[model samples]
Target: MSTAQRTAPAGADRTKHRKPPARRRPHRDQRWPASVFLSPWLIGVVALTLVPMAVSLYLSFTDYDLFSAPRWVGLRNYTDMLTEDPRFWRSVGTTVLYVVVAVPLKLGLALGVAMLLRSLVRGRAFYRSAFYAPSLLGASMSIALVWRALFNDGGSVTAVLDAVGLPADGWIGDPDLAVYVVVLLTVWQFGAPMVIFLAGLQQIPSTLYEAAAIDGAGRWRQFVSITVPMLSPVVFFNLVLEIINSFQVFTPAFVISGGNGGPADSTLFYTLYLYERGFTASHMGYAAAMAWLLLLAVGALTLILFRTARSWVFYADEEGR
Candidate 1:
């Protein structure tokens, strides 16, 4: 090789072996702005939520009467609730009944209404707004007051029954019927789930139905094979939410039953019972224990649903699996 070419090649080899410059990481000072911006949320979470949660947990194991300093009593509160308290189990049973009955009925009604809305051709917006109006209004004190008036003896409902030549008892007065009134109230406020289901139903492709029709599938067959399977995820979501909400149901029963859980304490839900124990009876520790138990129950039920969902909930992306 020529000396010039050899020299150029040697210079290239030296240049190839040279290290590149190192990249500079952002300074800690640069991250300060983001940290400052997040401080409010972090402070709120710690002060408002986490602290209260920890206090509640601590109070659950102690004998607290709100007026006096808490005395640590360990499992005594839980033991009494499980063994000595008949009202505890009664409240639990009432809550279980409400959750089991109300969740399915509300979800089914919501899904049905959603499907009906999805199939509508005209005045869809008006109907959607009208149907959802009840849910917005149902939880209000005004609506609860209205519910009380409607179901009370000698009220409009009773008058209607009398006009129809049918016997009517006080729905809110009868222990047997009080829970049913709450259930009816729950069913009437099905608008939120209906709106959610309507959104989910809209996401389903109409082409699936068209293809099923092409394959000679009838309406029922298409619904069973396509609609149910496709909408199972949304149904599961709504079911879980409804289960949680139903377990926490308090307002309607509280307002309609006059906060006494009246008619033999039949309308007394778990939350209402907790409120009575904590505030009225001043059994703060026992109420806290009840609250924790309720949390555990709700958590367990949610876990069970997640476990059960594996068998039936069909993810659109799971077809390959």
Candidate 2:
């Protein structure tokens, strides 16, 4: 080879065989803005949520009344709960019944209302707003008071029962029926799930129903085969939410039952009982133990729902995959 060719810089060869560019990472400086925006949320979560939870967990293992420093009691609070506390078990059973009855009733009412709302041709927005107003109002203290009044012996509900020749009695004072009043109250606030069901219903194409009709499918058959499978995801979502919320129910029960879960403790929800222990009776350590147990129960139930959702929860986009 000529001296010129041999002496040529290796730059020419290096350029031809250069590797593809490495993927770029977000620059450290560029990440600062996002971190800055997230700092408040992170601080709130740590300071308000995580710290309180940690303190409560520690307190759960101790005997801490509000007036005195906590003394370590190991799992005595828990052991007492399982073996000694009849009220705790009663609260658990009442909370379970509330969840079982209220969730299905609420979801069923919401789904039924959603289907009716979906069929409207005019004033749909007005009807939606009207129906949603109850949920928007929420299970507030005033609402609970009003609910209690309405179920009182001389209230409107009793008046109606008397008019219909039905046994006229105040449900709030009836141990056998007081819990049902609470269930009805929860079911009344079904607008949130109803809106979700409505959204899911709207997403289903009319063509599916039309095709079903062409295939000689009845309305019930069309609903069973088409609407249900498509709406299963929304149903699952609402079911999980309702179950969680039901377990934590307290305000309505407290207000309606006069803060004692009264009339034989028929409306003694778990959270209400916890509140009575913590703040009312000054059993802070026991209450904290109850709270942690509640957290575990809710988490376990949520995990079970998620694990089982694979068998039923359908996502259209994931079908081909």
Candidate 3:
């Protein structure tokens, strides 16, 4: 056979021995498992949260008294809220004051306690439980009632003040001080942030402190320079959370004020007033408008916090400072 014929036969033998290319199956859907797990939550959001928000938004633009059909009022509800409402403004002021005072005090106390707890070696769990117990019941009706009794005339707080030779009066009855009393209760529930702060503290590297110590830096200097920088993100988180929570304070004010927002409306938190307008005064439309405005205010505040956080919040994983 010729050399060309011999080469052709060799190529044919090689081709016959080679395996055919494996057939490729279509790509399997990997997102199915996640979608399956998320379907219930999505359903809940649509059925429970989103639907109610949509209804409330619609009611905000109309006069919706529960007894009668909703009447289209255009922007009257919002206009009245801004121009003609005194109680609304008072509630706004009260809520703002409560948030301003309570959030900072709460965070400060939380951080202090967290720092103390981190150094504790014995009975640490017990102390943590005791410190955190209040947050569990802080906003409950029973706690509010207990706080009211404790601050009322001849109550425990009044008696203590009297014993200390200080001015003793019913804290819940004074218009100028009733809001502060609510703020005090909020500050007392610092446990949640305390626990969060404790977690953040634990996450901090001990090597940083040791290195600073080797450089002759005092504890305070290390705390200010290393600790604060690392924990800034946690502080920012707790601050935003506490601010949002403080704005929505209602049960305590409602229970303490006997559902009337009494004592000249000093303890009239915005949510309490919204509840009063919607249920007590039968002005559902006005209440809905108030609720929407509150949502907007909180959203704005949260947005501002996020925008400002870029300048202060530090993440360990970030590069290029």
TM-score of each: 0.89, 0.90, 0.88
Give the top-scoring candidate (lDDT). 2
Q: Tell me the deviation in Å of residue 5 in model 1.
A: 48
The Cα error of candidate 1 at residue 47, in Å, is 1.9
Q: Which is the winner by TM-score between candidate 1 and candidate 2?
A: 2
Clashing pairs counted in every model: 0, 0, 0
Candidate RMSDs in order: 9.3, 8.9, 10.6
Top of the candidates by TM-score: 2
- Which pairs clash inside model 2? none
Query: Alpha-carbon error at 130 in model 1, in Å?
Result: 0.9
- Candidate 3: tens digits of C-alpha lDDT, residues 1-321: 588885455342245456333311111243577679999999999999999999999999999889999999999999999999999999999999889988999999999999999889888778888999999999798999998998888899989978998767877887887777788899999998999999999999899989999999998998899989999999999999989888998899998787888899988889999999999889899899999999999999999999999999988889566
Q: In candidate 3, which residue ranges exceed 4 Å CA deviation?
A: 1-37
lDDT by residue for model 2 over 1-321, one digit each (tens)?
688895565343355566333312233344788889999999999999999999999999999889988999999999999899999999999889888999999999999999998999898788888888999665788898888999888989978978999767988888877888789889999998999999999999999999999999998999999999999999999999889989988888988787899889998989999998999889999999999999999999999999999998887779788
Worst 10 residues of 3 by lDDT: 19-28
Give, for candidate 1, the lowest lDDT window spanning 10 residues: 19-28
CA lDDT scores, all candidates in order: 0.87, 0.89, 0.88
Please provide, for model 1 over 1-321, each residue's C-alpha lDDT reduced to its tens digit, 9 standing for 90 to 100. 587885554342245456232311233344688789999999999999899888888999999999999999999999999999899898998889988888889899998989999999888778888999999988888888888888889789878877888657768888877887788888999999999899989999999999999999998999899989999999999999889888988899898778888889898889999999999999899898888898898899999999999999989988998
For residue 152, model 1's alpha carbon misses the true position, in angstroms, by 0.7
